[model samples]
Target: MTHAIPVPLPSALVDHHAIDLERKYSDGWGMKVDDVATTPSGEMYTVSKIHRHTYGVDDDEADPARAHFGYSLISKIAPDGTPLATAVSGQSDLARQDTTFGGPTTGLGEDLWWARGLCVLPDGALAATGADDHTHLLTPDLTAVTAHHGMPHWREDDGPRDPFASWISTTPAGRLLCTTGEYGLYNYGDLLDNILAITDEPLTPVSKPTLRALACLEADPVKHTEADLRPGVLFAGEPVGMAHRPRPSLTEQLAKLDPTSRPGDWYNARLGRPAVVREDLFVVPVFGHIYRSGNRGGPFAFVLVTDQGEFTGQLGGMDRYLDSPFTGHALEIAADPARERIYHLNRYGLFAWTGSGDLKQRLDLEDKRFKPLRHFTLLDCTPDGDLVLTHRTQHLLLRIPCPDTLDHVGHAVENALRAYAKERTDLKKQWKPVTWHWVDNTAPVHRL
Candidate 1:
């Protein structure tokens, strides 16, 4: 019996890869984002700014200063300095809440309503399975909306709705498909619902003009009112982030490379695992690039064997260019047969985004140069409130000298700082500070 050597596979999915989508909506017309509460974990219980109140102001605040509705279920705020009953927290009866929040105009038809496992279908419709154990659909042109609870599942008896198929996709024949690990699930019907969520039209069709419109009917004021919008027939509200997405695609070309006379290639391992150079198995067909460390966890020196069996590894990261900590895209090994150079186009960040769906938001995985960062458990403050940083992946943990600023972090924590600087250095000059980060973000997944 013999084993195969393992290799790399190009993939769309990556861990700790966070991107921010600056949400833009249709200029006017909005909804009531309301509700309130929080968990002991310090996360808020309401959906987004829904709990925001018009507090500490004499008149209506400017829109930017106003509590605009962002992604539903986006965060959990632990009020830093006051009691929950304060009017500013939306808990007091005297608090006035603002409901007006939106973006520029009609285009991407998907208005997120507690959606999860959002799969863009082949025909441009969106298949959104939500936390509510139900899936919803919206037309690409933003013309229709439908709710679906009947997508087929593996197990039938009322067990808690399997979160597995919460994600969806479609085949070339337009067949609705979803997946969990290795198995694909199919949706069975056109099961539709009366969309009461939001209306692109101002009023229900049977009634007259009651709501404001961008283009109001002049000839027949009563007949052509925006009020023509009805409960069941409506348009998606101003979408959040890159709310409109295209269907996800896999690297089907890899199938040809899969030398499995055993028939189908291992799609599961291909999508979920990282590239390796082990003797027992190679997922991809690239030549082996073997590397070694001087000591335990020291620098890795590699021998790059191309298709021609050419090799080079001593200079990979051994003696020079030692400042670059291997992380994210910066860790990838590449070849330049033309320049005769074997180097990585590696940049900083925990992970690199491979999706073309949201281009405007090119997330820099590393934290900003001079910004303050705080995370639970991993990077937190001590009892006296000193800033403590812990490296989860590298098993390194240390506290900085000053609790409030990144300015005081000196050579005492050089290893962590080196890794952090490698991640923080802006490789791309166009790196823009995120305006509003809602996509592939940090909030808990239950709010997904």
Candidate 2:
């Protein structure tokens, strides 16, 4: 096993930051980071927090959402794994704590819920969401900018539904998207502003395999705890909660929908979570089954969301679309605006695809035995083509190759990234680090 020195967390995090995650997993047992993000302009940040009542989520009353105790810590780090005292040069959690600005420091318990969003804005600023229905935008230099509340995340109708943000990403033009981990994938994002009309796009049929996966999901409650088996809703549970499986429940659900309606449609709108922008198309993962398509040893399909914010179709069957990290879960999918392509993390590995049905590469962990040990959920890519992954595990946070390089990923990947460089002249130009003076190119692949 590969062992590295454990970086200690702040006393505030270990002591006063009393939350459920520590009680269950033991404080400082490992890195324990929840998510990670890096900017093409040489800035990187990590979302580290132990969620409140993380495993105790059940009913609203029995386990009141307010009873949950969770707080978030956003820390900046250098590409070489050194923790920077600050990023963009401002105090890390000060904006949230300062009530002088009428900011609910706690943010409606944003960290109290399952997820908090992090993204670098188009103009080089950082934007993060709060549980209190607020969006925090920090200038690229780390100075907090207060006017970003103008960027409302949810639509008018979704106000009362409590749209929880699970994942977020930005467009080149600065448009923002926020998705919910709360079942039904309620989208109260800025993308809704361009609304033409509530989409009436025909629902794509849930394939036999997808149906079987759902059937199995209903059969095994633990596979996905978010399943709700009510008359119309099946598996729409909150972030902390899990649904019980009833064997005949799937059959009954099919009977309730319009005969012409597709199950995929219901899930697209209801089970929306984790979204990113790709040119004109908005993409989201279809949580129809625990293992949609990419859960196995190789290539799998991902569900796409229509511009209308409804799940429209699936993108699969392409070159380089191979390899999965075994959880069969495609946790996060991020798009590269420069190349106009998409990529995702499955357990311990990473896969990329060119928008034109050409998959780029599948770079996985060196030790296959450790594949099961990885938590590949948190993912985001910088405009310069570097992918950032930060998530929690027993030993906590670890970058692909110690925060600075991915050369440890082995020979095949190195060659693929090299060949990918030559795929398009613009791609070559974009990968050039000098364009962004701050970008680190000390690694071997960087010199390529």
Candidate 3:
């Protein structure tokens, strides 16, 4: 009996390709790209690590007097994948902890260790939020520091006091949106308490008036007023009833979770990176525990908010996706402005949803083509509608082509042959790789 050849199906096509940014650009020590952003013209900017902290990994004890001495760089990538310029926290000596451009009003240069958030502002500036409770505004070309919005730990600083801008995003017309909270896991309950507009002009100076209007907790005329309860664990000798309060132990807190409990039901509802859908619409993901133990009910996967800081509704939770498990719990999201759709990345796969929260399509991670690009943590969409993804652990970016730009027929055949090669190992040696050729010397055409 003769075996019949499998025909190609359009559904088998994958339009994504991975790029190793770390291998291409690293300053001796292996770098890891943490967060990424894109300009209106498709230029990419990334915050990458130059050194990692050794306190937690090497030893449990942390030195109070000595600085961690970690560093990161911001790079500018042109649309064609060319490295244009790179900016670091310190300019003169890479070993020095002192900053080239940093202050109390702006932020400490050395505070950018493992920078967590990055976004493009309206005036074409770049805003990066660091893991150390500070945000820096850099020039569009990643050259100089234009401004820095530092969320200081103390309540009575010479500078303005703003919420912990843990995560940030920008509106279509130029407003700065932030996920508000205090420092550490003890204050996790306050993580998603408020998703508010922090500033109108992030590139400008962070003034006392500007932060007063954007303050996270209620201000008190009397210092250390116990009445004004706030988030944070009470540290001994620290100012009492100030910005933090005594909380349950971590062990006790973890004990509250039952199998049916949800993230919101317990205590903390940490909001992931924010994605602006339009001038009035934005979405934030509820990033639960790594194991997702308390994700069986309550808080939805993604929360929809208006530009005015109104919570409209939630989408994709365990309860709603009982039939389709992969649709729940997203980590990062990006908006395709041209298509008016949002792309969400979760453990299971990447899902596309319309502005009104309808599912458009889903790309599973288990797919052969997506397997190589599965380790990404950050996601951002370019103006031209392509996705720029950064790996969670590695210094890399995976540029996934938009569906409209993909050659449907070519992709189908290429994947079909790959599947066939796996199925018929005996004939794999005779199979040749697929390549594209110019059909008429004008437009390139792909052929099997």
Best by lDDT: 3
- Best of the two (1, 3) by TM-score: 3
Clash count of each predicted structure = 27, 19, 0
* Model 3 C-alpha lDDT per residue in residues 135-157, reported as the tens digit of each score: 66666766566555455444433
Models ranked on TM-score: 3, 2, 1
TM-score winner: 3
Question: What are the candidates' C-alpha RMSDs?
Answer: 22.8, 14.6, 13.1
* Model 1 lowest lDDT segment of ten: 1-10
lDDT of 1 by residue, 1-448 (tens): 0000001000111121111123222332122222222222322222222222333444434443443222332222232311121111111123222322112122111223333333344344444443323444543322334434422222233433322223233322333322222111112122111111111122111221111111100111112222222222112332111211111112222233234323322221112111112211111111111234322222222222211111211222232233232322123332212112222222321111111111111113244541222220112222222233322222112233321222223222334444444433331122322331112222223211
Q: What is the lDDT of candidate 3?
A: 0.47
The sequence of per-residue lDDT tens digits that candidate 2 reaches over residues 1-448 is 1111112244333333332233334432223455556776555665544333333333232322223333444555565444553221111122222121112342323322222566665556556654423345544444344332321232323333322233346555544444322222222232211111111121111210000011211222222222322221122231222343223332223324236544443332223334444645655443333335433433223545443334344555432234443354444576666656666666555556555435555555455533532543545666665455543443223333222223333443343333323432342254432211112222111000
| CA shift of 16, model 2, Å | 4.9
What is the TM-score of each predicted model, taking all chains together?
0.23, 0.50, 0.61
